[model samples]
Target: MATRTSALKLLRSSLQNESADFRENQWEAIDLIVNKKKKLLVVERTGWGKSSVYFISTKILRSQGSGPTVIISPLLALMRNQIESAERLGVRAETINTSNMDDWDQIKQAVIDDQVDALLISPERLANEKFVSTFLEQIADRIGLFVVDEAHCISDWGHDFRTDYRRIINILKMMPNGMPILGTTATANDRVVDDIVGQLGEVEVIRGPLTRESISLQNIVMSDQSQRLAWLVENIPNIPGSGIIYTLTKRDARLVSKYLNENGIHVAPYFAGAEDDESTSDEHREKLESMLLGNGIKALVSTSALGMGYDKPDLGFVIHYQAPGSIIAYYQQVGRAGRNIDDAYCVLLSGKEDGDIHDYFRKSAFPSVHEVELILGELENSDGLSVPSLVENINLSKGQIEKVLKYLSVEDPSPIYKERTKYLRTAVDYQLDTEKINWLMQQKTVEWKEVKDYIWYGGCLMNYLQEVLNDEIIEPCGKCTNCLGEAIFPVEVNHRNILNASAFLKYSEFYVQPRKQINKGALKEYSIPSKIPANLQSEGTWVLSKWGDAGWGHLVAEDKHNGVFRNELVKAMENMIIHKIDPSDFPAWVTCVPSKRHPELVPDFAQRLADSLRLPFYPCVKKIKDTNPQKEQQNSYFQCVNLDGAFTIEGEIPDGPVLLLDDAIDSGWTFTIIAALLRLEGSGPVHAVALTSTAVN
Candidate 1:
């Protein structure tokens, strides 16, 4: 036999055992260590097989026979996923966690005695006094390597922060000798990497790019509220795979999940603050796990509660019903898909109002020191406290309470936590008197009628409340189905079929669906309100009004750009009722020229707009449309964009009323702007309408 060098033999065997999931990019990382003798901190984007680095490293370390390896995991669910994968490969790996409460001593003994090759422990357990004391005293010198999973938590700026991370450096200090450190996380940013290195004291940085070439990202700017529901109904069936639909609130998560399930797409919903009806925590977890792993449930809708721990690599899509709090949040939420390096898509269905809604839900500032003191004071005597009890005792709002709890559990240094988990409120086997506890489950429903009413009849308050508060019972509407009549199943109705029927009925509704082929409103009547909807020529089309012409090119609303406008609109519309503006001013205010394509309909359309706006001029439709010529009187019907070309101020000209125009009333942006300006200029309230309402799209 030829004398083979050790490196040559190892290379030959490695090539022969190449894995299907391995990529050249992965090898580049391993090569830095194996060939260059450089300790690496490899960071790969989400779904890029970052786990392979360690799996391969395990063999390299075993061959070296230095010592056993240790992995620190953030969540028990995550630990299980990795442990199961290792077990299947005949790798001896085990995890220690609060889940195995009774066997903590046994697991600790294994780590001290070196009975385990690879051990996984939750961050909380790693910080445990008993665990830390034992590891520092006995096992500190035996460690081969340290793996920090979800290392992004080390950064205070990151969305998911773990307080336990602050002590990770301290733990490492207890180690007998310096060892190469690996920080792994899918959602690491520059800020996170800096924080990790700074906290760990000594570390090498290996950051992977955030871009995933295998994934496609699209932002769908829907025309109206109903279009989101319609898009799901139409496309969900064609693209069949497990997907996660993220919503801003639990109510929206539940409603969206229900709507998808109703439309033949079986969906399961996970919410942050939902009540569990099961008798045990395991039962609740089992039920949720069954729904996630079982067949037929192809989609799961949830809030951020589903973001941190869950892993199912074959996800086909992640749809954000609303924009997340930050771009980082947006990235992390969408990163859930394409984990297998397979083709997948992430679509964000955003609107002009998304940022405003996000602001309404985001924690505005850090929890005050006083607030934290109050919380600790309340819980000082108790071994553990439920969320509701904590909220009540601390006198903090529910939102504030949640933020505080998340901060304490994840972000704050030297945070206090109970060694207990909250299970469902236990029920007695004996029949007991039923009492309705002070539990409110707020929800919002997206039905054709509600969408239509919001666009055509309701004021800003109703629209704001409906969109912001869905699927939960926030406040009881005595008239709604759940309040008075019965709990209706959204499942009986088909969303797509309902939309198709509504589209066909547009003739009666004084609207027309743009032909599928002739987009850009080639027929003039079917044109979209915006410059041209990207999807118009492809699958669907809708009618738009004249104002859409200029309004479409205006700056898109975002939190950083148009927060002032949203705040002004919200403030002005807080107390006002919906009213229409006069028609005499409509002519100059009209942004797009009327179709003139319909000679017989000019006066008819004019009068319709006037009536919708409740304009005093052109009150007599017959007089305005009369063929006999009458000298027209001039009216103050124009509002001009400032000479500098900023948004035109809509107010009463010291001489008279000013006209405002818009393409449609989907979000009532135009109306809100005009209303705000008019209020500022002492012009009373705004009354306005479009050629047709665009809700129920």
Candidate 2:
């Protein structure tokens, strides 16, 4: 048994809680872990001291000559928090993650030399070829207590289900017998709990209320994206302190951050695959994370890339620019606020585009039947292949291919296995798991409705969220904006702020951050050079607004569909050419990239723009063959390949300084191909212009 004095001493040291004893539930969990040596599950609230149960138990068990604890956390942010917590408790901890590869060798040596106590790693590290081959086997028998953090992801029924987490059960199953195991999560409904319980086998379960008394929740429903943008500009300063502003996509993250910065808010945009100024180094991710910890910046305009396991105890607020897809995700994100404060805000600024954004994510969330078959068939025919190779043969995006492989690798008695670098097919025949697929889709539907309920339910927002998580809302919590009938957010729009926001969004300039490298192994068929020449590439492309959005974006969309742009667009482009673009670089002639589908639209626009400038107009590029629409193809590399050999210069090459016109630039490959062709025909210096841009990431 863990002595009361020892546990309290550890708690005081680790959390500075000043408590003389553990909470009843925490003690129960520790007792089962230390004395009983029984596996346990802790489904607790965000601030319920879940880490203390494991940290205290690790100390107790280590004293009894148990091996070092191995924790499979779901995020690098979580691992960082756990390591810090462990340090506070006087336990030596180190982590091996994607972010810190140079230190991995030293960390591994420390573990082998018995100089480390607790070791934290991301769940996806289990599937890492180098780590699995080099570290996992050696550490398998040395794990005294194996902990799975954010265990909710193991359940397909869970709102934030990840395919990688399901593989943790297999790791657990493969571990030495009688190893004490623990799974911890903050959000899980009845179905999710049952699913996790089934996977973990017989274990002690300690569940608690899904409530945070300190957080005041509210849904400030805005009429449009513009209103939401304006609301953020006006209200963010009014909100108490530094926090996170969550967006649905990376593009929005950048735009929101840009707007806030222009308004003197001093925020940063954080997202997955975000890099340093050179767009190669991952240092920016580390820097942003540090900024949040030190409160060096007011907030991070972020996508879900900033979500999951980031610990900021005194975080003052969490504002969702767009509502998340489900109660599970929303609660998890909003919970980041008020961890150590009494009155923090959890506000959701719901826009009309929220549902559309949610649906887009859902559609790409899983691989279809045909995608699975494509992967399995390719593997069956070869000895082995890697993800990059699979991307060349299979038309799926690198992300989609990797996702499919991740799903396949989690299957029990898995039919696909990786040896060293390449993944190989097992002897077993591959077949789609229709049952599992249907179940996953059904769960997504439930989650979609779950978000709607939170937005529309005419009761306490916190209570609604708790009930949605399968916990009883005993009474209305007056802490929420719904029950209190007030919020920190203002009741009406600020017209001046609205005008500024509209102007900011209206002239938002997105450049063609062109592809730095060609998609590997598919170059031979295109007859194009392996390397892109600098002169042929688009010097710059302007995105005046977002697609299907407010202000200029709406105008662009109507223009795209109606095949005619308004005079406002003409003036915006004219202003961009006059002020933003250099006069010496102005095009002597305007040429449009022909689209077989929208053949007349872009060409007509180019003519109008040239007429406005009194420059020559020519359709210098022809769509020689019918090809798949770039939007229909999700893979950027495939979009590049799809565009190759599909365009040819038409009529005579335009004279010096040709401007390339297009409706929108998604992959930027269209402009790349057309510009290359024009430059090859001795056309003058090429510049590209587009109405809008989508995030390449």
Best by lDDT: 2
Where does candidate 1 stray beyond 4 Å?
1-22, 25-40, 135-137, 222-226, 271-296, 308-313, 339-342, 351-357, 373-697
Model 2: runs farther than 4 Å from truth?
16-21, 278-282, 520-527, 632-641, 650-656, 694-697
lDDT per residue, candidate 2, 543-642, as tens digits? 6667767758778887778877877787788677766567887788888878777777778777888888888888768888788878877675677777
- The clash numbers for all candidates, in the given order, read 20, 0
What is the TM-score of each predicted model, taking all chains together? 0.53, 0.94
Index of the highest-TM-score prediction: 2
Per-residue C-alpha lDDT of model 1 across residues 484-603, encoded as one tens digit per residue: 243211223356665753332221112232222211211222122323233222111122221211122121132114322223222222111121223343222221112222333334
RMSD of each: 23.1, 2.3
Model 2 error, position 484 (Å): 1.9
